[model samples]
Target: MTFTFTVLIYMGEMWKGGPDTVGTLHKLTIKAEPGSVVTCRSAVTIWCEGTMNAEICVLHKEESQKTWGTQTPEMPENKAKFSIPSVTQEHGGQYHCYCYSSAGWSERSDTLEIVVTGIYYKKPHLTALPSPVISPGGNITLKCISWVGYDKLILTKEDQKFLSSMNSQYIHSIRQYQAYFFIASMTQDHIGTFQCYGYYNDTPQLWSVPSDHLKIYISGLSKKPSLLTHQGHILDPGKSLTLQCCSDINYDRFLLYKVGEDNLTEHGNQQTKTGFSLSNFTLDSVSSSTGGQYRCYGAYNLSSEWSASSDPLDILIAGQLPFSPSLSMKPNSTVHSGDNVTLLCQSTNKVDTFILSKEGAAQQPQQLKSKFQVWDFQAEFSMSAVTTALSGTYRCYGSWDSSLYLLTQASDPVELTVSGEVTLHDYKTLHSTAPHLENQDHTLENLIRMGMAVMILIVIGILIFEGWWSQRQDKKSTSHRVPEHGK
Candidate 1:
């Protein structure tokens, strides 16, 4: 007679050959090939490894009631490979495996989640709260928003597992669903590109299309690169702009970051005559959107770490407002030293403020609040005790409170000349005649002083000669008288 033994295990309880051998065996390990996150319609293999003498391996989806059992004879490597020829949303879930051996049934393996992406058509939008350039030990929030009302949103850093998930909150102000993931006490490890997805709770492993990549940068990493432009920061509309990012270090690339922007513009480095590695970022037909605070960073091709940010550069856009202002100077454009001069900026259109800019001046443009005058809105800029240092071509621009960085067309250029105790308007005529007349008068005065000096020296020499002659005659007379007295 042929006798057979059967074992049944359920909920950590096992019945081997008999009730005496009812102990749990070693645990099996389960993993996914390539990655746990797979695209829809792609092939993937789930691997379950167990002891060498394992007889049968069973794979079970935690969310479903069905189970897949395979005999160890099919896979000679003491493992079970379950291949999915064409993956679908149904294949996405958490899975575990168990192996049965001669001793007993093995413990259940750790859960491995399989995520199938591109299952939904709508994609989400990812943005950084406050800014993406964060300092170490600072906190940042990543906001994932979508028009489709997903149950939850998942945030994932590149090459990392799902970092966090949050239930979607409907924002009535924006009419969109969004989830905020807060990361506290940021460090260098948190600096990387990230993406987000939307998913429903019923099928946690199925996800929508990923949002666009957003990069998080850590500030104060290394030496900063320099950001500059050949043209001044103030620009007119429709003008082409090119900003240069340069660094003394041999960086392989450069990134231009605009404040309050979600994305960074990157460019490859090139050799330049300034002996620094540099990159040029160009914007064609610049508009008001191009104006903002900008900075740049240097990075290497092999590393994800970026250098410290460059100094902030503010770009101002002109010719945005409909009307321009008129600039005029009181007491004429030419003024003497210690004279108070007033520059009036007048606009017919209602203006909230006025900005006075001097051509080629290193200081920031001067701003003043506008007041309603008899005929128009105007602002007066007063200069007390003006000097030659203030001499330059000046222009004024009108702006509204709504757009601080945008300005009206520049006013007609006005030239201001501070003569500094001299009348600069007639400077050419005075320069041509005054020097020659002053030289002639100086030569005559010098000649008269030299003649008086010679006359005084001649009088002093005559007085000394007369005293010497008188003394010699007295000595001779005394010698003759002394000889007579002795006789």
Candidate 2:
């Protein structure tokens, strides 16, 4: 005579349980181990403790959404461990755990925010504007460049998400593919390790791998950095030179600028910091385009104020090339069609190379090594089967390198006139312009005579054809007379 009682189930805050029931939701604790940052496409486990015999649910808070909802977990049990097999951009958000059992639903656990990063796509390149160092009370810009067309770009400091819209005072769009985040009136708090990520519109949840981390530091400098070049003030063209930016105080970064150019055109790179930071700007090959007055600045890091401009150093490129080559053609006065012409370039001083450039020619200049002669050096440029197109003003120069800016002064230009087969229209015009002068030039006279002879022969051939056609017509008429005898 045993009796059993059944209780009606309701979705409420509390529930009555028997001996078979396990612990309630209030006794459970959910947590993420090893911090919240998670790499994309990796596995992460969320552990829930003390909620035995209960249905567990995970809730995610998205950046764009304010509400939280139920999410499925890989494993759901007491001390449940939920695994995210492949984390993506969408997986980056705040997460919480909830449990429901006979004792009713439990409150959500503390939120864990996760961030996913990867190298699966083209990442945005991060660069600092107006130099990485910012004055203590000045402004600076961080530029995010993505050429592969990304819908969104994000910047992070110390692995924490940074919203450009919220953190930056001004946002500038450099181009369709570039964005700049401007921070004004920077303080020591603004300095940190920074990285950038890019995201496509179709896969907004997925983020590109973090860019190289840029560490910014604060510096107090009253003097500018010293600018020094390896090769004195005068640099030889076609030679490599390095401009070093040095400072007396310890710095993490250095910047170099062409004195008169726009500040936006300044150049800077990550440099090693010893007792003092030393950054070197190398011109692999110097030319006239690279010669200018340069100044440098030093700073602790991106957030540090820049030192005052260093003493300006003038860089001049001087060539040691010999005198310009003298240009002369095989046939100086006239070049005829299908004729091979050789243009000889001679230099009184020994030259290493010769370059022949033609005026108004889109073609590249012809280059040749100079041949040692008894007292000078010479080079020959041959134009085979020359045409009117080859007739132009040509000049030559002697130099060791191929760069135009590094070569010796150009030689005097030589004019060439090519003669080709003259057309009938040209001949008529020539005759009309100068009838008596034709006999003086035998070539023109011969062409005119040939033209007249061809015209006479054509007329004679036409007359003969007309006579033969008339005879043929008469023969046909006579043959078709319907038999003259019967008529």
Candidate 3:
């Protein structure tokens, strides 16, 4: 009755039980970042006279009410075990277990607290300190931000991480201006959203929203201009054409800087388009000076930046205008005052236009590109009907280049003499050149007398014939009477 068996005891969470011994616990605690998961395997050994039920401490959720592990029986008389499922910081709290011993339930063991720690990724934000403008090529600065507590952060653009700031972050927070990110002269090269992140415990920070975009602007003038034809096509001087100045800029200035001239030969911006281009100039008249350089410039939309010239233009002006235009009669022979004649204009200069007028006409000059088909592109002012007054010095004016440059001087005056070839005054058109129809008049009385002499001779022949017939009739009658006597 006094004899008892002794079992060697192991240190650390191993307990020997007796009729008076109380249950004790070895609390295992864990710490990690929030949202981090931890798996804990707990084992307990109890030495008791009879089998007893035991449970690994219930994992109390620091936030939610839930147990981390299940209960187990000490079936091997002194061995018991339990396990904790995936755990989170929300499950962080005091945890303990109890033994269902025959000598009444043993007291709860020491608390097992878990501290979950791990880095978390949080959404980051990006903002521009000053409002930015976006142009083709522009400069920009942005503030990359992460959570306040996440001191260490990494910033990146596109996929390339900002290497220098990976370990440390300059802009700690937005409220306090400490550091900011900037791109030197932004271009198509720097066009993209930037992201950022920081090292955290379980609450891993994320990249902030991309910063506002920056715009670039530029301006340019045509050194060797590209000519833009409106109504027609690329034109040289003398040929009529409209010009336009294009740019990748706001339409606001589209009309303002409409058209301009090149500086090669002409004073800049002095052409018709420059002054009359509906937007500001019109090329009704073009010159060699109008052919060289052109430019279009203006501010960008709501930005300080400007757009460069759309495209350069090159224009060639036609050669000098027709030289002295002179008038002359057609058909080299003498033109009688009554004969119709056409006055031809010959040009010393290149011909683009021809003007026909009487000496005192103030009418507008007539354009003559194809008005009349004379030898080598020309027209004639004709005297449809000839008149002494219509014979005044005949002259003509011709020009080329829509702007009608120097015209040919008037031709020498043709002194015409008037003559009466035959006076059929009633049928004569003194000033007309239409085909002439003539009436021949001979003296009727003289011709009639000559016919009377021939008629008298014919009467004498008729009398002689009548006398011979009378004699033959008398002889026939006498012969008939003699035949009757013989009967």
| Candidate of highest lDDT | 1
Q: Which stretches of candidate 2 lie over 4 Å from their true place?
A: 1-38, 42-94, 99-105, 110-115, 165-175, 200-203, 210-219, 234-309, 312-487
Clashing pairs in 1: none
Query: Candidate 2's residue-wise lDDT over 1-487, tens digit each?
Result: 1111111132121223321242234755666654465676787766755554565443435343332333333444466567667766677766655665556655656666676668456766777766555567768787777766666777777745455521111234544466677778878777777777776655544567776766553434567777886565544577888888877667666777764343322344444544655777886687777766677777554444666778877664544464567889896648676577899999888678787777755443677999998888999998766666667888887766444235666788899888877444344444454678464456666877998999999999999999999999999998889688696
User: Could you say which candidate leads in TM-score?
Assistant: 1
Cα error, candidate 3, residue 3 (Å): 99
| lDDT for each residue of candidate 1 in 1-487, tens digit (9 for 90 to 100) | 1111343234224322322333367777898888888889999989899666877677777645556545453456788888888889889888887777767667778899999989998999999988898867889999999999999999998866447889999999989999999999888789888999999998889999899999998765789998988777678988899989998899998999998889889899998787789999997788999878898988898877778889987777999987789999998899886577999999989999899989887555788999998889999999876766678999999888888779999999999998755333233333344575445544555766887898889888899989999999999999889978888
| Model 3 Cα lDDT, one tens digit per residue, 1-487 | 1111111121112232321243433223332322222222222221112224432222223333333443444455433444334434343344444444334345545444442222243444555433233345445565555545455454455434232243335443444322366656555545444554444433332222222322222332322222354533223345666555433222333321223311111112322433321123455577555544344444323433333443433333323343455566666325555566766666544566665545432222333463544445566655544545444433455555654433444445554443444333313453132343332222333455677887987898799889989999999999889977987
Ranking by TM-score: 1, 2, 3
Count of backbone collisions within predicted model 2: 3
TM-score of each: 0.74, 0.42, 0.21
Q: Model 2, residue 411: displacement in angstroms?
A: 14
